[model samples]
Target: MAKNPESPNPSLSESPGPSSSSARSNGAPASAADPRSARSAAAPGGGQALSPGASSKHTLSARKGQFLISPRRVPGMQAMGLQPLALNVIEDTLRSSPDIEVIDTVGPKNIIGVLADGMSESPGVLVARMTDQKATVLHQQAQGRLIVERDHPLTLGDSMPLQPMMVSWSAPTSGQSLDISVTVLGRDDAPVADAAVYLFGSMIPATGTTDARGQVNLSLFGETPQTIRGLYVKPKTDYWSFYQTDPDIRTDEPNVVGLRPLADWPALANFPQNQVYGWGQKAMRLDQLPNQYRGQGVRIAIIDSGAATSHEDLKKIRFGFDVINKKTNPDGWSDDTVSHGSHCAGIICGSDNAFGVRGFAPDAEVHACKLFPGGQFSQLIDALEYCIEKQIDVVNLSLGGAAPSEALEQQILRAKRAGIACIVAAGNSSGEVQYPASSPNVLAVAAIGRLGEFPQDSYHAQTLTQMVDANGFFSPKFTCFGPQIAVCAPGVAITSSVPGNNFAAWDGTSMATPHVTGLAALTLAHHPDFQNAFKARGPERVDRLFQIIKASSHPINLGDPSRTGFGLPDVLIAVGLQAPMGMPSGLIQRAFSGAAQPQMMSAQPGQSMMGMQTMSAGFAGPYGGFLPPYLGNLQQGLPYGYGFGRPGW
Candidate 1:
């Protein structure tokens, strides 16, 4: 792809990709200038690849990473005559690179190869994860190989975690376990079923889901209530998550807790959040669009925590990859524990079956890629490779990392070349945009909130800043802002599906990105210019798509271009209804190729204000008895409404 000088952010010129994998078939190290040796130990929790001006001296470590060794250079956007390389080629490449540990290997036949050499789930997938300078050297030398990313950490913090994405519940001590029954209710005094209830006790942590009667029986380690640390009740949807630091427990009687409903505002009784489309859907004017424009022909992928396939609305989402547990439970990708991916899936393809919430593109083919709780960059890159091979037209990435990965940048370029569009979150740091989203090759979206769309006194109200515009839409104070923002969408108090046939109304740019991804699917399925192969199939197709979406968007009067790029994209205006335009040869490509903004590489190392961000009922409040940076920074981590609207840090 060619670089555009007139782009919003001036990006550093990218160096040519590393040498082809075939070139290093001899296993000898390429010189320091070329730096090619395919082996290094994997760092447990990897950091970002260094930018210019940072100390070049780093532990040259590498870990288990997928090795995409192909015999030929990558083909063009239209890979005409492309054929799978011979198996000997793969065998020879592995034989030559002894330093590159072979954790997994998937061959052409989907053969039961020794996963002691673990590889991609299916054929056409071979992975070897690694990071650090050793990983960088290997990637650069093995250019012809598809990609070798760090398997860097990714979380629902829709972010990359500083620690390995592993959190464990303590097993109970030898003392007798006591059973306690708890009931969850909504503000309307209605029983809240399918809600996740957690009890953080001194010696034991117990968790359970509320049943139809809104009751959950929990067994604690001690007979007395003294072992309790805290209690957290998270509803499936239509209510706020409730957390109590300490509570007076009367084990003798039934315990009950109530949550605030998302639709509690007396003035907006007509708006039933569960039955009606979310404000985000209406803001994009999905209701105004024709019934025929549903995302029926598009393939959309969401990389986040797993999703709850049992959810009625998300039942259409059958295709998935459990990147977290690929080999063990390859078919268990839909096992959403965190509920983040389920939310994004609902926003994109959730159906309108029997009192369920409808998505922007309810008919689109949905593929869920679970990587939350803990995900790595290497994992993300591998997922992208799957997307390219899977013919995924659009992908939603509602996660971020503290630092940038040059390997990821190259992979994004490849995905773009392969004609896949990536929609990413701008981050919730209240600072410059995060990587991937900051990459000009992708579309980065910020979060915007409209007044009266949520309960006035609920946690959702905490996101209201004084920045309201004439239309009542305000740029959230937590949204990462910069010249890289491509657009804004409804992120505040967003109501979407969680795990276990439930729903939750939350905030963060993570909640905003899916709107654009869903819209992109609809555009590809219906927009005239994107309807045919000639106009839509090419390296620059997404760039052209971005041009159309941005050019046709109506920006809210937020008065900050950094906060709201082209504002919200209008679906009707894009799909040839409101303002249809003639499709000329390379018309949009020529003018809009350079319009994207990817200016992240130029920032000084550590200037990135982003930290580990995980979304848990992000209503302003002080949280975290765990660790710093992991749960630090309100704008970065917990932005709940605490005293004076400050972070827990």
Candidate 2:
């Protein structure tokens, strides 16, 4: 929650007369001889604690025929035998007294009027007449400089009084049927008209559909208090699909589910051939890995602006929520309002279809947690809590802010305690890494583009280094540098699915984050024992996973270690298809020599040199083309903060 500070003192004048300093030029400063000195001397607390609205009386002399009067009390002045003229009434008054002329008027509510310079009335006589008319003649000035003085209007203070209320509900009975009511909402929490709901794992299958209010009622029957193991919801047209296997449900409370609609993908007259770029497949070495460990049965959540569920490359989205709208389901709307989350998702588990490009973990279950538009602190915490409750294996958070939030750090810690691994972008600000990436538990990834394999049309292509260094490949101009960076990945001009059933290219550390996320999913899929180790070793499991990926990376000899972390992670080596390289053989052994050992081997010194040469040459071939600038009209900046990516110059 955001806090509001108290309002400052009002600027309006509260004194009955203007101080001598008020008549000075705008650039002049107050002097010791000013009238404020007398007011300060007479104040109750010696001026230090004087209230802005405190009132006081003072006497002063002014030139004859110069008087100030509030136009609003003109009628009262006429009754007291004093002439108070207004602009409209001047024509009428002038007919009676031809010498009188209205000089000026000021102020909003109480219009202050300066009488003519040639009037025959004396200042003393005018003041006496004003007193008799029951009108306030605040002050008199020789040059006809009229200043209005009155109490300032009342305002509601900053803080509001809050009242607490207590209520009680009937406890649910054990061994009795329970009725659960679920509500489905669209983008911005709009109600879904007709959504089908199903309840599995019961003696008899129960099903219901939402009406106009986006609600449905279902009864769960069992001998004992039954837990809903599998709840499926299929929304009407334009809505994204939802499936929650095991929900955190209490028998006593109503189970309300909010849904967001998947925005329709822009239609196209002709479909382009889905060509998987070299950076997408070669950088992670997805071609060398086997299909069996393609992230099947693993649940990975993309905590970003939601994904394009309607994308042809995305085979199925298991579950999704619009954190921005506080809904459980997509309201028939695409989650990629910024087209960032969808690009990240394409690199994670895009369907391995013939027409579109395939992802590293094509079969992994993907969940979109939309938190971009309204990326509030509490909304982020709620998204993480949703992941924990769902028992998601991995969470990819490409968003980051410069200032660290302790509450956000605690949420990441809680996710870690719940056996969930968080992978974050190291940021594209070209400075120190941003949080929650800087936090100890999450894996912070940096960006790296191939030397000669640069995207031709990309602005970063001209800034690419000529040769691949010991750090594998480097793209230094835009990537952030810091000790928190865990690894680097191909991030420049990477092509992926957009919201309109189309493929486009993007550049950012945000684009690099999902590469590591996909690899983590593959690791969990291939090594089921890692999950068991996560339960037993706690955070050490995360450390071991990080070390394995780091150790398996192809080391690059960059000038600054902070720019590239350990090195570029090779999915082939990470999943045990290829041997680990670059780092010392014994160091890799010592890092993973724990109780939860992964399948790894020490590389021979002589063979390691030959393998590095072979790998370097192989990576050099894909280093030449340019990525066309597709997002020419989109605004630059990560959804949450300033550290993501900037528009190409």
How do all models score by TM-score?
0.62, 0.50
Give the Å shift of residue 254 in candidate 1. Answer: 13
Q: What's the CA RMSD of model 1 in angstroms?
A: 16.7
Which ranges of candidate 1 are over 4 A from the true structure?
Answer: 1-100, 104-149, 157-236, 241-257, 263-274, 532-534, 580-594, 597-649
Q: Any runs in candidate 2 off by more than 4 Å, and if so which?
A: 1-278, 327-333, 454-457, 462-472, 528-537, 586-649
For model 2, residues 533-572, the per-residue Cα lDDT tens digits are: 6534245566667767777676555666667766678887
Task: State each model's CA lDDT, in order.
Answer: 0.63, 0.54
TM-score of 2: 0.50
Model 1: per-residue Cα lDDT at residue 385: 66
Q: How close is candidate 1 to the true structure, as a TM-score?
A: 0.62
Query: In terms of lDDT, which candidate is strongest?
Result: 1
Alpha carbon lDDT of residue 598, candidate 2? 19
